[model samples]
Target: MKAAILDQAGKPLVIGEVDIAAPGPHEVLIRTAACGLCHSDLHFIDGAYPHAMPAIPGHEAAGVVISVGSEVRTVLPGDHVVTCLSAFCGHCEFCVTGRMALCLGGDTRRQKFGGARLTRGADKEVVNQMLNLSAFAEKMLVHEHACVSIDKDMPMDRAALLGCAVTTGAGAIFNACKLVPGETVAIIGCGGVGLAAINAARIAGAGQVIAVDPVPEKRELAKVLGATHVVDAMADDAAKQIIAISSGGVHHAIEAVGRQASADLAVAVLRRGGTATILGMMPLDCKVGLGAMDLLGGKKLQGAIMGMNHFPVDLPRLVDFYLRGLLDLDTLIAERITLDQINEGFDKMRAGTSARSVIIFDT
Candidate 1:
């Protein structure tokens, strides 16, 4: 299998052939179809996030099930699926209580001494699978819990986004914040995730959907998605503008940029008693919190891992939204490239010029 191998942090991903193992007892084997190059991947490649070296780095993906292990009953050969990194152990305390996304999923992966799922070169050195899915390769061997069968009618490229960007963004509004129809929302960042939030906000019937980003083109794109208002993230009075547009602070402020300033902005623009959900994977050492005034106002700040998603229930619904013409995935995707162009795709992402770039594998 060909994969984008990250040899180390702060380095370019090396594209080369790697070996993928067959599925384990609770695993599924998938033929990689399409995978999105997300900012999260960039964070790992740029060393902002730590991960095992010589790993395949991709989480947002959609593919066809090729085979399944003896115990895997959720999917079978020929089933189309979207993969999520938040693999859950069904009996875990979190999963049992309906918090599957928060499940540590510790048991989902093979034990350390049980051999690796991937290897490279003649030496056959272990190649870590990033976030369990490792969909950047020609194939993925992952726990069955990591993926859910989606409608066959859903296009693979668009389905890929549901794995992470869309799931996280839409889930933030639909699940995490429990956004009311008439509530106001300000999404801080116009990237794929932010745009998805804007679209979901519209579907949720938000009274005011404010899109904040420094990029003019993205701000325009945000409007196309469903933002009722746009604000320059770099503007000195960006928060003021958002508050003014909503007639007060927004009921929900989401930080998708994963920056200290953006997180602070999300906190600052919240209406009294509003909630701020941080979805970005910020630096490991970074801290995000609310001030005394924010606490006094009943403003809440928290993290929503994978938008607190339940993939078994959420991924298929998202696919339905896209198939029904309600979710505008066509506008969400910026371009498609081949696996060999993976490095160049990341370069574009680093430049912050494109929306979501997907790697289309030759099946």
Candidate 2:
């Protein structure tokens, strides 16, 4: 199978062929159909977040089940699926408490060395699977819990992003932030994730959705998706513009760019009692600073993991929303490329030339 491998940090991904193992007792082998190149992948690629060395970086993907383990009954050999990396162990303390996203109970994968999922690559390497799904290649051996069944009719190209971008964006608003209707929101960064947040906020009935970014193209795109206002962060008094348009402040602010500055913007734009949700994964060493005096207004800041989503439940609903024409998945995909062209896709994404470039393995 053709897979993109990253053996070092701050380097371009090496696209090549890799052999994969079959499924285990609770795993499923999926024929990769489409995968989204996300900023999280960039984080791992740049070593902003340390991990096992040789790794196949992909977490947002949708595909068809080619085979299943003996114990897998939720999906069949030909079922269509969208996979997530927030695989839960079902019986964890967090799972029992409804915080299953924090479960880290998997069989402690065997490598201490970075990057080694394949043993035949000469040195018994330990190419780490970014997240658990590792859907970058033509095939992946994912735990059953990491994948969810979606309607076969869903466009695999766009459906691939639901596993991450859309889910994260919508999940932040509906689940983590628990936004109220007619509330105000400002989402910083107009990338795919940020765009998804803008769309979801609109669906949630936000009265004033403010999209902020340095790029005018993205701000325009954000408006079409549901943002009532757009702010060019490079322009003078950007945050003040947000405050002015929103009339004092917004009820909820979200940071979609994985940067300290935008997170601060989300915090600064809040109205009394407003909340802020940071959806982007900042570096492990980075921190957001807030004054003790800011809490007096009952304002809050929180983090959202995978949109605070449960694949088994939220994925199907997301698919339904797309199928019903309520969610705009088409606009999210900037272009489609074949599996062999993945490097180009990543390059385009890095240049910020597209909202999202998908690796379309099946079509």
As a TM-score, model 2 comes out at 0.94
In order, what lDDT does every prediction score?
A: 0.92, 0.83
Candidate 2, residue 234: the lDDT equals 71
lDDT per residue for candidate 1 within 1-363, as digits (tens), equals 888899989988888899988788888999999999999999889988888888899999999999999899899999999999999999989999999999989999987775899998799899988998888999999998999998899999999999999999999998899999999999999999999999999998999999999999999999999998999999999989998998879999999989999998999899899999999988777898989998999999989988899889998998889888899999989999999999898999989966999999998
TM-score of each: 0.98, 0.94
Q: Model 1: residues >4 Å from true position, as ranges? A: none
Which window of 10 residues has the lowest lDDT sum in candidate 1? Answer: 107-116
In model 2, what lDDT does residue 136 have? 84
List residue ranges in candidate 2 displaced over 4 A.
105-117, 122-124
Candidate 1 global TM-score = 0.98
Model 2 has an lDDT value of 0.83
